[model samples]
Target: KPNSELKLQIFIDTSSLEIFINDGEAVFTERFYFDNAPQVWLTAKAQCLTQVYRLDGQAITFE
Candidate 1:
C-alpha cells in the first residue's frame, strides 16, 4: 500500500519520550536525561499534517 496514510503521536515527559503510530497501533519509547526545555524537528515529503499540544493543563496531579 503505497498511498496509505500514516498517523503519529509524540509525547515528552520529565525524562522520557514516546511515539505512537497509527493511533497507538505501534509505538516507540525512549528514555533520556535533560534539564532544559524540549525541542522538535520535522521533515517530510508530499505535504504532511502536523499538530502540537501542551501537557500543562491535560496532566493530572495526584495528591
Candidate 2:
C-alpha cells in the first residue's frame, strides 16, 4: 500500500482514548485500561520519519 501523510491527535480521558487522524479522515477509537500508565509507540518505514511526544512536553526522534 502507498503511504499517505497523516496527522494524528490523541485525546486521553479517564476511561478511554480517542484518536483522530487527518481531521477524522481515519479514526481508531477504543477504551483501554492498564495497571500502569501506557506509553505511546509509533513505527513507520519506507522513508518514514517519526516524532514522539509526551504529555510532559518531551520529544524523541525515531527511525
Candidate 3:
C-alpha cells in the first residue's frame, strides 16, 4: 500500500478464520485445525504496525 494506510482484521472462531484487508478491499478465508502447530510465523515485506486480539464468544449465559 502506497500513499495510504493498510488496515487488517482477523477473526478466529472454532478453528476458522476470516481476514480482511483495507476495509474489505481484499479478504482471505481459511480453516485450520491442528492440536499442535508449535511455530507460527508472519512475514511482511512492507513496514507496518500490527495488532492482535483474542475474541470471546457468547460470554454471557442466557436463561
Candidate 4:
C-alpha cells in the first residue's frame, strides 16, 4: 500500500533494537553493541506526525 497511514513502534535499549510495524503486522529485531552512545534520525518524503515515549525501570540488588 502506497500513501497510506501506518503505525510503527520502535523499542531501543542498550543492546537491542525492536521494531513493530502496523501493530505487529511486521516486525524486526537486532542486537548491537557500541562503544559510545548512538544517534537516531528520522526522515520522510511527505509530512507526518511523530510521537516519542520514554520508559523507566527500577533496579534490584541481589543479596
Candidate 5:
C-alpha cells in the first residue's frame, strides 16, 4: 500500500518552516508571524495536512 503523509517541521530561530510531503518528494518553505496567536494546531482534510505554529514557540513537529 502507498500511503501519503505530510510532515511539517518548524524552526523557530530562523522564523521559518519547512514542509515535506511523502518523505521528500515535495517541499515548501514559508515564513509567518502572529502577534496574538494561541497554541499550535494541526489540521488534516482530504489528502492534505497543515500545521500552524506560534512564533513564540521553540519548535513544532507534525507527522
Candidate 6:
C-alpha cells in the first residue's frame, strides 16, 4: 500500500530497547548498557508523523 499508514511503538527500560512497527508486523529489540538516559533518533525518507512518549510507572505523557 503506497499511501497506507504505519503504527510505531517503542519501549525503553533499564537495559533494553524494543520497537514495534505496523502493529507488530515487524519488531526490533536490543540490549543496551547506558550510564544515563540514552538518546534515540529516528529518520524517514519521506514526510511522516512522529510522536514521543514518556512513561513513568503507570502514567504516560507526551514530550
Using TM-score, give the best candidate's number: 4
Q: Provide the RMSD of all predictions against the true structure, rounded to 1 decimal.
A: 2.9, 10.0, 3.6, 1.5, 9.4, 7.0
Q: What is the Cα-based lDDT of residue 22 in candidate 5?
A: 55
Clashes of each: 0, 0, 0, 0, 0, 0
Which candidate has the top score in lDDT? 1
After superposing candidate 3 on the true structure, give the runs of residues whose Cα lies further than 4 Å from its correct spot.
Answer: 36-51, 59-63
Ranking by TM-score: 4, 1, 6, 2, 3, 5
lDDT of 4: 0.83
Rank candidates, lDDT, best first: 1, 6, 4, 2, 3, 5
TM-score of decoy 4: 0.81
Residue 59 error for model 4, in Å?
A: 2.6
- For model 6 the TM-score comes to 0.67
Residue 39 local lDDT, model 3: 36
Q: For residues 9-46, what per-residue lDDT tens digits would candidate 3 score against the true structure?
A: 87766677777897899999988765763233556676
Off by over 4 Å in 4: none
Error of 1 at 25 (Å): 2.3
lDDT values of the candidates?
A: 0.86, 0.72, 0.71, 0.83, 0.56, 0.85
Better of 2 and 4 by lDDT: 4
lDDT of 4 by residue, 1-63 (tens): 889987888888778888899999999999977668666677887887889877776889999
**Alpha-carbon RMSD, candidate 4:** 1.5
Range of the 10 consecutive residues with the lowest summed lDDT in candidate 1: 51-60
lDDT (C-alpha) at residue 17 in model 3: 71
Summarize candidate 5's per-residue lDDT along 1-63 as a digit string, tens digits: 245555656444344556566566777777856465324555655566555544554558789
TM-score winner, 1 or 4 = 4
